[model samples]
Target: MNKSRNWPVAVIVLLAIGLAGMAYQHFKFGEERKDFERRWNLTAAQLHNLSIVSDVPSDINFIPAKEGSGYVQLSGKLKSEIVRKLSQTEPASDGLQLDLSSDSFSIFSFDFRSTKSQITVALPEGLELGRFQLDLKSGGGSVRGVRAGQADLKTSSGRLVVSDVKAAQINLHSSSGKITAEQLEGTLTAATSSGGMSLTRISGDGTYTLSSGHLNGTGITGHVAIQTSSGDVTLSQFSGSGQIASSSGSITLSGQRSDSLNITARSGNVKLSKDDAFRGIYNLRTSSGSIHAPDSPGQTHDVIEVRTRSGNITIR
Candidate 1:
């Protein structure tokens, strides 16, 4: 029994030695990695305009910082030294500039196959900026409880999310990413190419456009104009009127009131609530699909005009 135990101990020691040797070789080849982080503070009241541009795929988050304690925090774990050096914040005379580009080469700018960074921009709590802008090549950006005079947030192929944001004029654009916003007030303009949109409790005049994704919203109280191509438009609790158009998708709306609404669809269905309590002339027409409505078309000031090619029209 003693001899057997000695052999087992020897085998264990040998295995441990082999593992140590492999780890040593791997480390000796410079395969080690180190993360880089930077944090700084600035006066929020001194700055008004903010611009952030990133070329890599990064998660950019904005939060309300402490009073008079605004800061910009950037961190990344990258292999290239140039990328680590380029990721920094510069305080300008009027505002601040943040560039989070890993590779300075503009040829493969949007190729997000290499490194990703996380950025945190902490603004002063309850301090609104004069203007806000973020242009990301291939990343996602999110913010909550922030106010700006005008905000223009765009991403080439990533998501944009905002909550409880109040801006006088807001523009959100995404090429191949989704846009999700809630509790927004003022003039809003949103567009997406292949990504959808989800909005809730928005109180403003808005214009939305989508290429091949869905547009869904609720509790909207504004004169809104919506257009989509090969995507669906679904809204509820809407209390304003403008126009809604779709090419090859459905339009479903449940509203409390409307002044004058115009809806046009190429080959999709239209559904509305019969209990909308609006005395309007519903000019509903379709080429082949059926129509179920509570009122017929007549000359009136309040006109709910609906036209489709080959889809059912239901106002019940």
Candidate 2:
């Protein structure tokens, strides 16, 4: 009996068994993946069945249903190949509804990239819900709503329009786009990089930061700060204490009065004007820029430091 012949037979048997096991595993994985994809596609299709009217005004209305807590979220994207189908309204699915409470709070978000898509949210005459959150995003989606208690809105390169937002905590961000908000109350923080920001009135405490753009606010209360790299920083009526800094642009604080006022720039003018008298530790410094404190009659307990590498400092 040759042992070599028995060795060859055993090797052949092992190879056959390995091939069979691999084939079984490959088929099983493929089936599971296919099933998962099918279910996901089905769920998306159902969500697309929801109402998605182009010309219809974008609005989210919520009435105190259970009175314990409630949530509303709206999110969408511009018409792009990557997000085209995802933005479409689908029928409700088991995963579509993210109900926080058994019958209290709900969250809804979608995507829309159509040329003519707009969203607006309004609270009915009398509705005092607890802990409400809303998020709206689009390539060209305009979001207008009255928010209260923690509201956040962001856009990549679209127009953002918000009005009458009264939240305990509010945050808004936009990238390379335009943002307009009015009558914002509570702790608010709005920012835009390489875009424009215009706010009517800000009552409470907040900060606005910009990379290379403009930030114009009508009224700001409490502590506020505005920073820009290479753009204008203008505040019509700013009260309380805050700091405004810019690199190579003018910072005009018109009719501004703060307990602790601080303005610094690398190569731009710092204009601080006050209608009446103010009292605080004022700190104004600029290099290659001017500081004009004409009507600002306050006790500068800190120091009126002005230094310019290549520009003049003017204190009026």
Candidate 3:
């Protein structure tokens, strides 16, 4: 009888131990999901500009709100301690600024560390903005459906994407990250140190400069000027004039409408497509490579010049 009673107690003790072990494991390795949301009712007439500054890794998305007055919504997942410090906003006479720095003692001390966080911001739709600026240090982000008078986007080491932007002027600068923009209707000025750039369906003039990456564009409506140090260039379906230069990469252009086309390459091939609608005076020359301009149109006032130091030129 003692053994039987002891067996029951022993079984109970074993079960308790197992339960405790399971609880400990769950506490140590279970997922932690923390989220926070904040909303700001902004006066659209008073607020003309919006700026976002961050130092941590974040993915920012901007969507047009359907209802209500102009407002700003910020929602993200981060540590509770970090979330407490995210409430940094300043309203000036001209615009609203949101700074999401992860440094705790930023005012009185110096700390260059940032916690891992994901942030998303949504802006009101149909609100006319005078200026929109996004300055990020090390996070990948995207901006969409923004209609501003002027937009400037800069990032240090993350990819940047902009789409459906309607601005009078748009400037994008990136260091060590790729940049992509589509459906843009403005004068674009883009520069990158170590990343490729791609633009599509652009409606205005553009000036692109790259140090060590490719430049690609399609369906451009206005004048375009491209300069690359060590990367290739490819343009298709261009409707305006163009001036392209490359140091150590090939250049290829295919279009049927242009007032003038000029290309200069140092050590790469240059190719152009000619059609029945092409009307320009051909000036193709190369120092050490062959020059083939088979379909040079009848003499015209417009000029199509292609020059290369040590690469072939083909006009087909």
Using TM-score as the measure, the top candidate is 3
Q: Which has the higher lDDT value, candidate number 1 or candidate number 2?
A: 1
lDDT of 3 by residue, 129-220 (tens): 88888887777677777778999988899988888888999999999899998999999999999999998899999999999999888887
lDDT by residue (1-316, candidate 1, tens digit) is 5687699889999999977876766523332334768775667654587777876556666677865588767776544543455454457766777766444344422322335677777777677778888887776767665578998888897888878878999999999999999999989999999899999999999999999899999998989999999899999988888899999899999864775789999989999876445665888889989999886434446788889998999987
Off by over 4 Å in 1: 1-34, 44-46, 57-69, 78-88, 104-118, 296-300
Q: Which runs in model 3 stand beyond 4 Å of their true positions? A: 1-34, 59-62, 79-82, 88-90, 104-126
- Report the number of the highest-lDDT candidate: 1
Q: Residue 106 in candidate 1 has what lDDT?
A: 41
The parts of candidate 2 lying over 4 Å away from their true place are: 1-115, 118-137, 280-284, 289-316
User: How should the candidates be ordered by lDDT, best one leading?
Assistant: 1, 3, 2
Cα lDDT of model 2 by residue, 115-209, tens digit: 23223222333443233443333343444444444666666566667776676887878776777888778797888886878988778888888
- C-alpha displacement of 41 in model 2, angstroms? 25
Worst ten in a row by lDDT for model 1:
104-113
Per-prediction TM-score: 0.78, 0.59, 0.80
State the weakest 10-residue window (summed lDDT) of model 2.
30-39
Q: For residue 153, give model 1's deviation from the true position in Å.
A: 0.9
Pairs of residues clashing in candidate 3: none
